[model samples]
Target: MNPNDLVQFLKKDPKDFTKDDIIRFCEENKIEMVNFRYVAADGRLKTLNFVLSSKEYLDTILSDGERVDGSSLFPFIEAGSSDLYVIPRYSTAFMDPFAEVPTLDILCSFYDNTGKPLASSPEYILRQAAIAFKRETGMDYKCLGELEYYVISDVDEIYPGVDQKGYHESAPYCKFAEMRTQALLMVARAGGKIKYGHSEVGCFTKDGKYYEQHEIEFLPCDPILAVEQLIIAKWVLRMLGSQYGVEVSFAPKITVGKAGSGMHFHMLAEKNGRNVMVKDGKLSDTAKKMIAGILDIGDAITAFGNPIPTSYLRLVPHQEAPTYICWGDRNRSVVVRVPLGWTGSTDMAIEANFGLKRRVEKASKQTFEYRVADGAADVYETVASLIIGAMHGLSMPNALEMADKLYASGNIFDKEYASFLKKLRQLPTSCSESADVLLKNRKLFEKDGIFPPGVIDAQAKKLKAFKDAGLSDKLLGNEKEFAKLVQKYIHIG
Candidate 1:
């Protein structure tokens, strides 16, 4: 579809459009219905054949929704109350570019029979967190995530290459540029507003002899929109790759030794249309406290940021990934860095400052960037935790003291910082440990019933079982394994 077609489609009242409209559109466009499926929170999918000619069938499936055995899903409904429904949100509709017959896609949300939001639903947690933050702190947080993922040549096997070609190495070195361009197009077609896409120098490898490179790029969108983009991007990449016989992994670490992918979240708190993170051309006290809150709750939050066992592989020391709980100006070694703004010059005006700079920079203006999260995480959960913690900090004046202590403590692994780390409470190490921490700290996340007791227990049991079954062992070892072991019990997401 061209820009005009998209504009015409957008002009139509989506609510009035029936199944017939969709079928007619698909038929007119030579789109295939089989290319689409209803994805549920439980990770199960139901196929929708194109043969259905009735508009009511589409209405029932899209609006009336469908029931699923929630007990089978991850940490949602238990066996005793296993009934749940998935309602497709029309706003999320898009065309699958890789389908043999172009297929329409829609993202679904899980709801209880009573129409209440499911406690374990990431979307629910996110909305609750956002609402609570606004109500408590009088601050409106806006986030744009810079998602960095790799596009590998094959998916069936793990191929590790050490290439050091910094950002935008171009052509032969960046073999996946064409694929990324196609992916970006799909993202645009899906209504995701992207700032830019280019090679991430952070994940490059160059041995002076062998030149193999991996491409990394950023896609910018509002917090909710970004999560939606991620979901659709994953699907698009998978579908596109299948067509090209190539595969990609958003896994934090695809191989044993390599730069891990990170979903660096750029967040700013706004009030009455002004960025709250800035004050007098510098980072605001509230922003500092927010940063502190993240560090204070860093360990626990890691559970959501780095949810998978393999995620630990990318968070080790000296790997450009954060291993310590500290923040500094433009220092990637720390968990959070307030990048330096253009100093002593108007050309380097702070207006250009965005992303991490918006939250942490004060003199030059800054923003807070939660650096620990990875692609495997439920984006909603990760963002929710950060928003909640930041809001809590904003409400409490003492949070500044906490932030100072965290900043002064330096690296958590260092002996000198151990005292501060101990006082702040350690983060969970293993997935099971993280789940246990969540169970123990349920009150922190349970506000407004965002995390119910039953849901928490279910997650804990699942994580424990996963650990016992050796999933962590198979995915992580060495520095990553040891780090997880140490922080296995810290409560996070």
Candidate 2:
């Protein structure tokens, strides 16, 4: 069922939405548990469980959401003051096909003691930006994230299959063929629209041994719903991986010297049901502004989009994870790509319960993809921050003209592109540099107070401290430093 069904079930408050109808729906699906899922500031998904069989218990908990000790959360929550409330949105409800207990899961947002929405909360921050985007532009934005990851069995840890190249390899050659099918099923059941998934061109290496790498991609949809699907998809993969005797890794660079995974975002804008990004059979002025916005603060936003040190590892040249600031049409090597729609391709509409496919518009209109981030980035923060940057750039005079000059200057993949973009502008080189960029462009985050100054300060301080501590060089010692770093922050939602 769609979220509208659950929303219609609640006659009282919208968020207090689990009612008899929802109970009946749960019973029909044999759901034994209801899970409330939220992300900490570091983007890790945390869960709070409640029994779904009893309506009274559901009412009690929904009326007064369970309190969380915020001290244990990521940097967004202050250390000394530690009380926050999590309230799940019924609109986020979905059935998990991989859950052993047959659970119902809903993504949640945070609230303060006085019941006000927590501005620092990533979900809340994204929600505020989305609302502002709709109000200011009189247009809606839809985005889909194509997330990539690696898989290996715990029993056979650190084995990076032979030759270290495995992009688009099918069964007999690919061990993940069966597992990928199951992953797509679970993703569809959990309300994800899967465009496609395949093995990526990456090899694993550890202790002087070589192995394999893989990637699964999805079509673009609503930003918030798309992010929620990302969280669920990762959960499904991990849970099922355990059952299948494999471990999943979403780290930017799982192997030290191979191709790194990137979480690319394909975005489009529309107003009155017509795409506003396209005008006169070309990218419109508004589209240029959006691209300008992305390129303008691309490095500053990397403080959130590519949050970790290893994240920078993946941003190097020729790995498919972009390093330079320039954007190119159909160029995967660049930071941003204006993709040409594939010929003879049909627009697909994947159903929530199965792979229900349909045809929609033709693939003539171009879609924008930001390839800087990986699975490690916080969905809410990255999208929200990007939106903030887009709006900020939209306010600039001759923004479209500026964007034209920025990307049309030189071939970004050339030897001189680094200096070329630097002469124009380029992405920050490190966490310290990224933080410095953010501090200089602080107004983008502070507009409308959607992202509180405290949150920006906290992120900046943490990045600065990470730099000062030399953690990039000192996170862990020995050949296992890569694995250690991945394990520390790779599970982020």
Candidate 3:
């Protein structure tokens, strides 16, 4: 099914819908249970479910939310801290297709007893960041996250090394075709608008190996909805895979020396529903400003984008993963790539300027894709940091000019990787390095107290502990240890 056609099923923004609307829908559909999901400090999904039996119970939850132990989720609340409230965001409600019974999964937020947004809540932080940006610029942004993962029957059944080839290979070569279709179809039914799902470039090459790479690219939506869709899609895939006796992994390095999955985000900024990233067939001032801000904080943002030790294994220089701190027009080697038909502006402008009409078919208006993040990172925190960086750039006078220089710098990841290091910095090679950067630059995120005052402190502490333990050393050097670790954490089984 065309993804655009699935838009009609999407739930309206929570702020736009009334409590009565959701209650009415639940009554009409007879959704027997409600699964409330929220993001932990580490960005993993946690759930508190309820068996719905009456409108009164539903109404109470819709208004007051359910209370849960906050201390259980790391870095969220202390052991003695008062229990936090898990308020369901009605807009995120979608049917759980894999559940034994008809159930609704609604993404939720953490709040204190007085109904204040919890400082430790990633979702709330993401929302505050977006609202802060909109308040300052009077413009809103929409985003989409492209997710890639490996589908295999067992964790050990992975395709490794240069011999494996699976990018868009048809049928027998892409043995997981049926799984891909059902996963994408499940995403759509769960209210996500995925543009397309296809076999990816990395897979297990061994004849008997049952491993394949798959990608699901979503259409642009607001920050809250976009992140929700990613989490929902992942949750659904995990559940569906279990029924089929398959293993699904979004781990950065499922296997050493091969392509790792990435969760690239696409974004578009608009003011009064008009594209603000492009104007009159040129890169709008807003677009340049945002890009400049992103570049300015590119390396440090990795704490949330590529936070784990395994992530570094995938982001090395030679692989498809981006390591250089630069952006290029459709140059995947760079950290950021403005693809050929990005936002349609460049494609259309080229035709009008050079009479290349035939190539304008996919021309878009004004959209930007941030390719630095990987699937293993925390989505809410990562996107929030991205928004903060972009908005911060808008405040700088030379942001646009600086962006031009970086974009014109060519592929910094070219043959002379060593030479480019003298000018452009490489992405942080470890969780510790990136955490240190965040600690030093804490003020950037704390501006106007938009993010909680101690967010940086808390995050730094977490990363520091992970680093001091020497987890990265063990994961990278010992294959036996790495396989065991991947089986336990990465497989999501």
C-alpha root-mean-square deviation, each candidate: 6.7, 5.3, 4.3
User: Which scores better on TM-score, 1 or 3?
Assistant: 3
Off by over 4 Å in 3: 1-16, 154-163, 205-209, 342-363, 408-410, 415-421, 468-478, 481-488
Query: Rank by lDDT, descending?
Result: 3, 2, 1
Over 20-76, each residue of candidate 2 has an lDDT whose tens digit, in order, gives: 555666766667888888887666678898877576776666556778988788665
Please provide, for model 3 over 396-455, each residue's C-alpha lDDT reduced to its tens digit, 9 standing for 90 to 100.
999977887677345555565456457776777777888888877778888756667677
Q: What C-alpha lDDT do the candidate models reach, one value each? A: 0.62, 0.72, 0.75
- Whichever of 1 and 2 has more TM-score, that candidate is 2
Measured on C-alpha atoms, candidate 1 has an lDDT of: 0.62
- Write the number of the candidate with greater lDDT, choosing between 1 and 3: 3
Please identify model 1 stretches exceeding 4 Å from their true place.
1-8, 12-52, 79-81, 154-162, 201-222, 340-345, 348-366, 408-428, 468-493
Clashing pairs in 3: 159-204, 343-364, 343-365, 344-363, 344-364, 345-364
> If scored against the real structure, what TM-score would every candidate get?
0.78, 0.85, 0.87
Q: How many clashes in each candidate?
A: 33, 5, 6
